[model samples]
Target: MEHYLPSFHLKGKLAAVTGATRGIGKAIASAFAEAGADVLLISRTDSDLKEMKEELQQYGTNIYTVSGDVQHYDEIIEKIEQKKIESSIDIWVNNAGINIRSAAEDVTEEEWEQIISTNMKGAFFLTQYAARQMKEKGYGKIINISSVAGHVALRTGVVYAMTKAALIQMTKTLALEWGNHGIRINAIGPWYFPTTLTEKLLQDEEYVKDIVSRTPLRRIGKLPELAGTAVFLASEASDYITGQTIFVDGGMTIYGF
Candidate 1:
C-alpha cells in the first residue's frame, strides 16, 4: 500500500492550469502545488496571476505565471511553447470557462460566440497543444472542467450547457486518439460550487434552496471536494482511467428519484 500510495503524489511534475487565478482553477493549482508539483498558472489578468503565484509559493513548490486567455489559444500556446516549460508539461487542466445565463430565445449571436469560443473551442485546442508536448514525452494527464448542467437537464444557460456537453465529448474522443501516445484525457462535471461565476446565483435564497432540494446529498459542493477530484484525475493513481467524466455533484446527477 505504501508503494501504491506514492503514485497519488505529483512530486516533480510540471502542470499548466488556465483560468487558474480564481475559483476551481485556483483550487486545482494550489492542490497541484501542495502535491509537490511546480505549477504554471495561466490567466488573462496579469495582476491575478502575479498574486496567485505569490500565494501558492507558501507550498514550497515553484510557481510560475503566464497571462493568457483561453479564447486566444493560438497566441497563448505559442508563447508557452516558446518558453522552457512547454517541453515538460506532465499535466494540463482546462479550468477556464464562462457562463452567460440567458434564455434560448433571448440568446444573441454575441453571447453564443463568447460561450462557445471560450468553453469548447478554446479548451479543445489547448488540450491539443498540451497533448503534443505530452506526446513527445510519451505520457501526460489532461483534465477538462465541465459541468453537470451538460449532463442533466438544467434550466440554466443553454449555450453554456452546450459547450460543456461538447467538452465531455471532446474528452472521450481525444482519449481514444491519444491513448497510444500515453496521453490520458478525462473531464470533471461539477454541479454547483461557490465559484466567482456562481456567486450571484448562490446569493439568491430561492435558488440555493431549490438546488439543495434536488441534490441527493442536500448541499452544493465544496471547493476542496472538487479540487480533490482534480488532483486524483491528474495524478498517476488514475493512470488507467481516461475519457470518463467524473461527476462531483453531491449525488445530484442521480437525484431523479
Candidate 2:
C-alpha cells in the first residue's frame, strides 16, 4: 500500500452508519468495513439490521448494530448510549432518509413533516450529538447522504428536494461550526441508484430514458461507485475537505436540459 491510498487504510477507526440495512447505506457500511474500520449499522428494523450485521461479519470486520428510528432524538441518544458507543463513533453517517413523490400542489402537510423529520431534523440532531463527541476526542468525520435533487429539482416533487437541500446546508454549517474542533463534515449527492426505494422508477422505461439522457454518463450509478466517496470522506484522505457536497450524479447536476 502506497501513501496515496490513504482511504484504503482505516484500521482502528470506528464508524456508525444509519440506514445500513440496504442500498447505498449498506454499500457504504460494507466499504468502510473493507477499508479496515469497525462499523455500527443503524436502522429501524431489527431483522434487517441483524441480517446485515451477519453479512458484514463475513468480511472479518467488527460489526455492531442497533435498531431505532432516527426521527426521535431521545430514542437515538438512548440507543447510542445503550450500545456503549456514545463517545466511540468516529465516523457518523446520516444516510437514513425517505422520499415522498407528489406534485407540489398535491403534497400533503403530513408528507412534508415525514420527510423533514427524517431527512433534516433527524440528521441535524444526530450530527450535533456526534459533533459533540468528536470535539471532545479532537477528531471525527461526518458524512451526510444527500441527493442531486438538493441541487436540482426532480419530478419527485418539492418536499424531498427541500429536505435534501437542507441536508446540504446542514453539512456546510456543521463543517464550519466543528472545524476548529477537528471535525470534518461533508455530503454525497447521488443520482439514480438501483434500490428498493427506486425500483418503481427504474421500471418505467420512459423515465429511465429521461434520466439517462440528462446524465452525461448515460446510466444510473451503481451502489459500489458511491462507496468510495464514503470511504474517502471517512478516512484521512479527506482531512482537508469539509463543508462540500460531492455530486456522484454522472454529471446530472451540471446539465441544464
Candidate 3:
C-alpha cells in the first residue's frame, strides 16, 4: 500500500465542549473550530457563551452556544436537543470541571460535594449523553481535560485530586466499554498553563521559579500546545488511540523536587 499521512482535519465535524468559555476548555473549542469543526460551546454563564460564540464564528465554522451546567447533564442535553443539534455531534469534550483549594483538615462537606458533583459526576453523565449520540453515529471522539495532578501527588486540594484521578480511571473504563461501538475516549493531563484562573500565580516570581525548577522543560505550557493535543485526539489522527491520558505537563510529572 502506498504511504499517506493520517488526517488531522476535522472538517464537517460537529463538536461539543463544556466549560468552553475560558482556560483549557476555550483553547480546545477554538482549536476545534480552526480545524474546521462546527462547535457547540457549553457554559453556565450566558454572557461568556455568547462572547465565545462570536469569537469562534470568525473561523467560518458554525458556532453554537448552550448556556447550561454540567451538573445537570440531562437538562443541558435537553436544551441542545430542542435546538435540533444534538444528534449530529461527532466530538464531545468533557471539560467542565472545578477545583477548590483547601487544606484536607479544613475541607468542608459543601466544598467536597461541589467539586465532586461538578468534576466527576457531571463529566460522567455528560459523557453518557455524548456517547449515546456518538453510538448512533457509529463513531466519535471524546476528550476529557484531566490534570497532571490526577496521575501524581501534589498540594492541589485533596478533593480536586480525587476528582481528577477519578476522571483518569473513568476515561479508561469508558474506552474499554465503548471501543466496540466505534467511539474513542481519551484524556489530556495538563500542568500549569497561563489562564485567567491562574493568572496571579503565574505572575508571582517565586512561584514561577519553583514551577520552572520542577518541570524538565523549565517553562510553563502554552495554550496552543494543549489545544493541539486536543485537536489530535479529536481528529482522525488519533482514531486508533483510546483509554489513554496524554500529559501536556512540560515534563512536570516526571521531576519530583
Ranking of all predicted structures according to TM-score, beginning with the best and ending with the worst: 3, 1, 2
Lowest-scoring 10 consecutive residues by lDDT in candidate 1? 1-10
RMSD after Cα superposition, model 2 = 1.8
Structural similarity to truth (TM-score) of each candidate: 0.96, 0.96, 0.97
lDDT per residue, candidate 2, 71-179, as tens digits? 9866978877887753387899999999989888998989888889999898888888878878889999999999998988677778999899998998888788888
Give the per-residue lDDT digits (tens) of candidate 3, residues 171-229.
99999999999999999999999888678878899999998899999899999999999
lDDT of 1: 0.91
lDDT scores of the candidates, listed in order: 0.91, 0.89, 0.91
The residue-level lDDT of candidate 1 at 141 comes to 97
Q: Give me the displacement of residue 186 in model 3, in angstroms.
A: 0.3
Q: Model 1 over residues 5-89: C-alpha lDDT tens digits?
A: 6478999899999999999999999999999999999989998988899999999988888887789999897777667663388
Selected candidate, larger TM-score, 1 vs 2: 1
Candidate 1's TM-score: 0.96
Clashing pairs in 2: none
